[model samples]
Target: MKNYQRYTKMFSMPPVRSMDWAEKTCVEKAPVWCSVDLRDGNQALIEPMSLGQKVEFFKLLLKIGFKEIEVGFPAASETEYEFLRTLIENDLIPDDVTVQVLTQAREHIIRKTFEAIKGAKNAIVHVYNSTSVAQREQVFKKSREEILKIAVDGAKLLKKLADEAGENYRFEYSPESFTGTEPEYALEVCNAVLDVWQPTKDRKAIINIPATVENAMPHVFAQQVEYISKNLKFRGNVVLSLHPHNDRGCGVAASEMGLLAGADRVEGTLFGNGERTGNADIVTVAMNLFSQGVDPELDFSFMPEICEKYREFTQMEISPRQPYAGALVFAAFSGSHQDAIAKGMQWRRDKKCEFWTVPYLPIDPADVGREYQTDVIRINSQSGKGGVGFILQENFGVNLPPKFKEAMGYAAKDVSDKTHKELKPDEVYRVFLERFVENRPLFDVSECHFKQLAGGIEATVTVAEQGKKSVVQAVGNGRLDAVSNALKKHFGAAYTLTTYEQHSLGEQSTSKALSFVGVEGDGKTGWGAGIDEDIIQSSFEALCAALNNLFVSRGKD
Candidate 1:
């Protein structure tokens, strides 16, 4: 294998032998999506999906409205043969569905692949052999002329076998690495195979051309499609299919470009999970059409469910951030991102599902299996009010007043400055309620609490010394300053009230209020809060909460 790092596919497999140029126009039409999830996907699995897994996956494809699903290479194993038998005996194959199997042109494997397809209401026997010069010279050890005879010989055998078994089987042919094959010879060989099968309109043969190794760019793929679409004598008797891998990480783009070039069908696996790098990501390609207002016609509402089952069956990891179908694909962690998404969601809803245009969003989360809600309440110092408010609304269903939000924003800043990380949702709630909304704390502090030592005057403050107690009373501009000035008096000149404010707290006129105080004790900003039915009492309580906040900031456990 060539260093795939330097090339697209894993190996220097072959160069596409040039084909005779032809002029053909692309005919726009509805696309047929053929899922190769079972075979192509299975090859990439660390532990191949079991027979049960194949059966389950096959059924999922059928249930999702796939009329043609390539079940497996039945001739490859006893287990695969049994799975095909189970699909047949259980009457699971939909009448309109055509069960397909992969096999080489070798008589026995083709016969065996067909044997597994027997008794199906409708079936397709897809036979292929590598025909490129590289295959002939290196892999197959034969000339192109000899490989053509082998392929055509295989087709003849398949035709007789299908007639003998009394099964209605359609023939599909591919030159394994079709893109690398000489175009004139490839068509010559495909035409030779078609002559043996003699396809009628009702049983049109599917000529599946694979960009098997992504040796060329997309426009080249277009030219190849146009080449065959023009030269084929019986266009009505041909179903043009394209199977492109993601070795170049451009499978979806290549597939779309192929469709534009007149491909009638596409073959791919979900999440692009297949052999080396992966197959074309049908989910992304189809959903890309969805975003463009074209009906992808495939319902991916159960996309995550499909992904989960495939991961379990195939034992392949799907990146959490993979496009459209990953766990974190719709998750927003940045504050700006969350804000934009929230606003976009609102605008989309308000436009009556019409006038929505937003940044950083291609499709709505709800279009796939995603929810706009999250447990992400942690807003840090770097966060904005929008993020903090969102967390509060999600976690506590709390509608914060504008001022309260401002206070909590500072609190979050204080915490984040220490931790240097976003505060978790629970932490945000704890800090908000601990300092601002709640009027009372659960316990008494050593330095600050209501006491008889201060005479008839009541007050609260924070003290940091272990087992230390000191009380002082002082007159100040107001009740808040009086209490704060008392803390400075006790803690010495190092501690003092910097600023304080009180506001009416409750719904009724007779209802009391709450207080906020800022102290620069020890030369750092310490803001406190409290609310109660009594304005003065509320002020004292808030001053104590601020003091307690200082204690908390000192790493109190």
Candidate 2:
């Protein structure tokens, strides 16, 4: 029976073809960073992280590199207000990093939010109010004229408070849900706020136009931002920002499109952790820049650590497949993907990349923190010769003969069909070892005698090599060592163990340990792998397979 089209789908990842977003978006250095962990992100979290969790999450974000962090709305709660005051009283505020406090246009909360950041070295009072037609009718119950007054009066009050503080205070304001708001009305409210704030060229007013619910496609988001940036007043002293959520899972794409349109800053959480579907994945967005040969301006490689810290603070699980920061983003699972990755890595080793062209990889894992080279192997009905070939190439440094690759693949299929499942690690290893190394039937009941004698364990291992030679043995630290030493005597020291590494071959403690070791003899290096419940026996046989590689390499030489 022919297999279904499973492996056919992985060949079309976006990184394989795109290359222009980086050059256009990140050219301006030192862009403003507005973090939404408190307001936008926290609101989306399922549990709405506790006060302690919120404070810890904020501290980690501030520590990572964000200069402007939106600490929660003090007017919303006594608890939140106390948290903001705690930041100021503890003097955690730095000279370069501005403490940002958010509030609505309502006078009481707005003033209270300002009071929360009163004694900071540098600060930003980010006041926001809903301006979309739906929000105005449903939430604020205000018309365009009424919303304009709310925005203008709030900006004037914020400007006055910053002036009174006599410190380096910056002002930023967003017309909430601006993506759906009429362009003319949104621009009017934004320009009025900019006029009231009277920002200088040195400290441009940040105009954040949020696709609050992410109702628009990426192109539409870009168009909306472009429209506003062109129409907004104080173009010289204006920073266009976008805070698009991932209600539709296109947060990263939308953010990229917005940046291309005219956004100077994009606010998002690390793994797009936020309300609903989460915010735009800043991780993907930033790494896209790195992949395109442009500096992303921010050092986001602290990704895993940062995400782990996020997990600790928010008590949330970071999905294993999250982009750039996920556990498995850099890992390959299919045979074709693994082969491509292996070749790409080899090409990159030369270190003189003309433009970072490699298959199945947009950014190197090393640039982040992933270091393990793995292509998750599986025994599905659709898997091909490439899978076994990769194991030979990657685990043993052996490129199988064309006939060997196809024959082994059929062997795997036969075993899989019999077992009604994919071949387990031990099963896979045994097939190859018997053919080329141990020279014995993997399941043959060979007699093994072990005795703690002399300086170490003495082992005599005897078996019938399925089609080639009789079982031999070797000796070492323990039973396996003795068996290996005994085998070497007869095998003429074909290969010796340079290093032995054992890890769970798959997701089972009951699963056999898979062993890989380096071998050197006759002036060359080769690797071999074996899997078995008996770890020592597995290593012994695997080393024998590696040694046999000497014969193949010698012929090639």
Best by TM-score: 1
TM-scores for candidates 1 onward, in order: 0.74, 0.70
- Across residues 177-273, which tens digit of lDDT does each residue of candidate 1 receive? 8777866677788888877877788888888888777777766766777676666656788888888988778898778777876678888988898
Q: Give lDDT tens digits, candidate 2, residues 358-457.
A: 6766776667766543424444345556666655555544455444455566656666667777564456656666554454222232556777766787
Instruction: Candidate 2: list runs displaced more than 4 Å.
Output: 1-31, 349-355, 375-435, 442-557
Give all candidates' CA lDDT scores.
0.72, 0.69
How far in Å is the alpha carbon of 325 misplaced in model 1?
1.7
Residue 268, model 2: Cα distance from true site in angstroms: 1.6
- Clash number for candidate 2: 18
